[model samples]
Target: MLRVLTVALVVTALVSPPAAGQPPRPQAVTSLLAGMTLEQKVGQLFVTYVNGQRADEEHPDNVRDFGVATPAEIVAKYRPGGVIYFDNDLHDNIDSPRQIAGLSRGLQRASKIPLAISTDQEMGLVTRIGPPVTQFPGNMALGAGRSTTDAEQAATITARELRALGVNQDFAPDADVNSNPANPVIGVRSYSGDPKLAAEFTAAQVRGYQQRFLTWSGVAATAKHFPGHGDTATDSHTSLPVVDRTVEQWREMDAPPFRAAIAAGVDSIMTAHILMPRIDPSGEPATLSKPVIDLLRGELGYDGVVITDALDMAGVRQKHPDARIPVLALKAGVDQLLMPPKLGEAITAVVDAVKSGELTERRIDQSVLRVLRMKFLRGILTSPPVDPDKADAAVGTPENLAAARTITDRTTTAVRNDGGVLPRRPKAALVTGWGENSTRTLAKLLGGKALPTGATPTPEQITGAVEAAGAADLVVVLTSGLSGSPEQQALVDRLVATGRPVVGVAVRNPYDVAYTSVPVWLATYSYGAGALESVAKVITGEIGPKGLLPVAVPGPTPYPLGHGLTW
Candidate 1:
């Protein structure tokens, strides 16, 4: 038998019944659920991806995958409850904010019910939308700032831009604690290594994302990779990773941020594609493990929409076929199956499961009701078509950009300044390292020459950077993935050997400092334009170093969490 949500939990946890004039009437949700067919109900359980920017445009990938040439045709045929936008090779669903708003309107026009448009706009490395969208340095940057108000402000700006673009759902505020130094996937994506700090930032971001704006109901904030994807050395995108934390360890390390998110009334929680032997020995990933989900539903009391990570990933596909994955996830108490490998097959399998009595229609109704209630609560059902013309005005305004710069400025962490090399204005400087764009930007800002190198620098590139450093009084080297790349570490060592004052700026991972012996070390946590500009200002003594280290860097002498040097 499928586990059903208790009425009290449904009322309190799932629906979050409004105070006065808020929406999602229980009767209206019931009426809508009563009208959906089994196929329609099953369709509501999957959030699929489309290939084109415009709903009416003919795209070859859409034709090949869905037997339809246009997004509108796919929506009409499949009637998916939601669609996620991605800018990958298969799907180029974003161009400009105005274009996205128009596409969203067309897709909603094609569907019988309004669609919940979503994207992974978690800022920093994972931000899907770019440019005219205000770019804030991501979560770890926020973690370094250690200001809950800044975290909320960043989320509020992001929510405004996303809502203006007609996207209503954000897979954001990662909420994972980066306890393991070698975690492959979630490095700077997490807020902090300390659970309590991560928890505080998570709750603040939730409130920011869900706060209603003028004429716009709030965007639905999702606290993701539930149970926790941090503390693992492997990446889930390639294969399943096992986290061996016992129940007590998990509660102490991984559960605090999720718990804080729940108390902050996050609209949804996304399950990770990881297996924990201590939590569930059934060999199923958390996305398909009922026992693991019980920890969220039973122990944590989260009855909100439980969404699975992308179904096409290798983590959840182990030993399970494409069709059976969706069925197992639904049985495991997941409300939404995200980005299934084969959308039609996944939907049909669930419908067939209901027909064969393996899954009941009542169980299907429960999830659909939860989804419908969220759609109603977020004003997706009642809101008018997004105005494409006003999208540019709403997104990336001057005020919002200034706010983003302020937040990024506060996150420039000075991990080490042995000779007080930072906050020094150098007449002649050489800027070189990983991240070509970031190096060029910093060089332009600092009035220095830029010799940009790749993440894994070639020997020739290292020699060229070393030659360039000889002509300058100071050298600024940007490093990324230094822990794994000895060549990049070698480049930093060579630049330091030049006998010039060398400042190593880690633009991606702050842990790069642990692998280098540079006299001066700083972490921007991001290579975005705003972050690089902030780093330049700190180098020139325009601003003091204020950011604390969000994660511990291990070495012969370790830099513990919350360590930073201020001048």
Candidate 2:
């Protein structure tokens, strides 16, 4: 049987609701709070991660980094209502999508309550699937376009792939509308600068993509950064950033996409750790803010589940250094306390809080009820049947991968070019220390040698590389903008200053291209194997540049959005 534990537990309650010839199975669901033991109800609100497996460890999957127990043991021990999967949690045996399905079924079987398995496979940003997988540029890349069709398409494929592997819920299609490119963390993770466009795209993504499980009976979608976390410049992993926007400004800028997502029936909302004094003056994170949670539940009319960002993030850690957060989060209306790093302690803390009247049992029961209701609606309690192989039509097939390649290819941008920089007259070339891409491999493909430099190249590196060309042919610099680091800008400026025919290509975010005046440049939005191969083919002049500037490049923002300049 293709059984996941959460569904199994739910099915245990549902299997005998009516006769086999039932007209419609009644929509009766257990109030996980109503009929369950206190311990079981409290367990319903906690989510743990289990990437490692050991015999004696206390916490499951060692989300606390203690490596105490394996993922299976964690589920069996705590019976958490949800589980979060990091890249490390994947079993190595999952070479194809099918194997991943089997592994997921096995994990789900270990749980007693219906478990919602969530993975942060943001489609293109940090995919853990195998080769032949098409890479969609992260949310930022898709945001540059006029329509959200691309994002919807990419999300559809993502849902299909994940569902094939038995992943029920995905924390993706980030609804954060980022207005600033200088945002150190959420730059590439977001969709766009325009709030309305981001909302429209996110709506399409959730509506079009969230239908995967509904349409295919397997995958479900969750839109994230609820109550808005994209506009702030600070990284939530470090400290809680105070979004200085007033309520009116927030409604205008940051609230649209989330509203759109809610309209689209998103299964869950992940709270941001950032502080919004305007929304909650207590200086607590949105995760532990009753005002903010109330805003989502009441004002926004959100009737779905509410989950907190990882309790281990510094945003929560700094405020409560004692690891007693899951209790406070429950009191604040959070349904799931994700990856607390201290499961038993977190559970005990909640129990203690209820005992002392610091946290009420009724409050915890509210979230538990919501969780159980959802499972009941999905028919997991009585009928926990899954066809892990059925998603084969959607996941990893050539059709889906081809679509991934098409969008990825569309994002490769040309940031700059002065005096017709392409089609170099001479054949000589000097390539070195561009970015962390396969520049040398491409150079070799074009029958040239790639060299390593002793000192990090200065404006002199490009000049030296160009000058060393000695009128040979072309000097191409490949640089990667992992986080759009300043060192990246320095490298490009040095290369462009060389006054050679510099074609600087950013293998990440297109916004990183505006910093340099490189005579020629491109942004290939992703660094996957397919992305690298495509960029390499373009560099060797084997293929004409078919990509357009997905976003506005500095200076010669020559091509308008989606403009493809043909030679």
Each prediction's number of clashing residue pairs? 0, 22
My TM-score estimates for the predictions, one after another, are 0.95, 0.83
Runs with alpha carbons beyond 4 Å of true place in candidate 1? 1-17, 20-28, 212-217
lDDT of 2 at 272: 87
Tell me the RMSD of model 2 versus the true structure.
Answer: 5.1
Error of 2 at 338 (Å): 0.7
- Candidate 2 wrong stretches, greater than 4 Å: 1-27, 31-34, 53-68, 88-99, 130-134, 212-218, 376-395, 423-434, 438-472, 480-490, 497-499, 533-567
**Residues 1-567, model 2: lDDT tens digits:** 333444455545553544432212223344334567778888888777665322222443255443344566767778788776655533222355554555566566676665776677775555656554445667766664344778778777776566566666777778887665556567567776667777887887776556532144434566778778877878888877778778788888888888988887676788888888887788888888898888788888887778888888888776774457887777787787887867788887888888899877777777776776555433334344345576455566788778876776555555455787764433666665544346666466556556533224455554555456555466666665523455445655665666667666666666655554666766666655566655555666545566554444433333455554434
| lDDT of candidate 1 over 299-406, digit per residue (tens) | 999877899999989898997999999999989999988999888988999999999998999889888988877776676765666889999899889999999989
lDDT of 2 at 23: 18
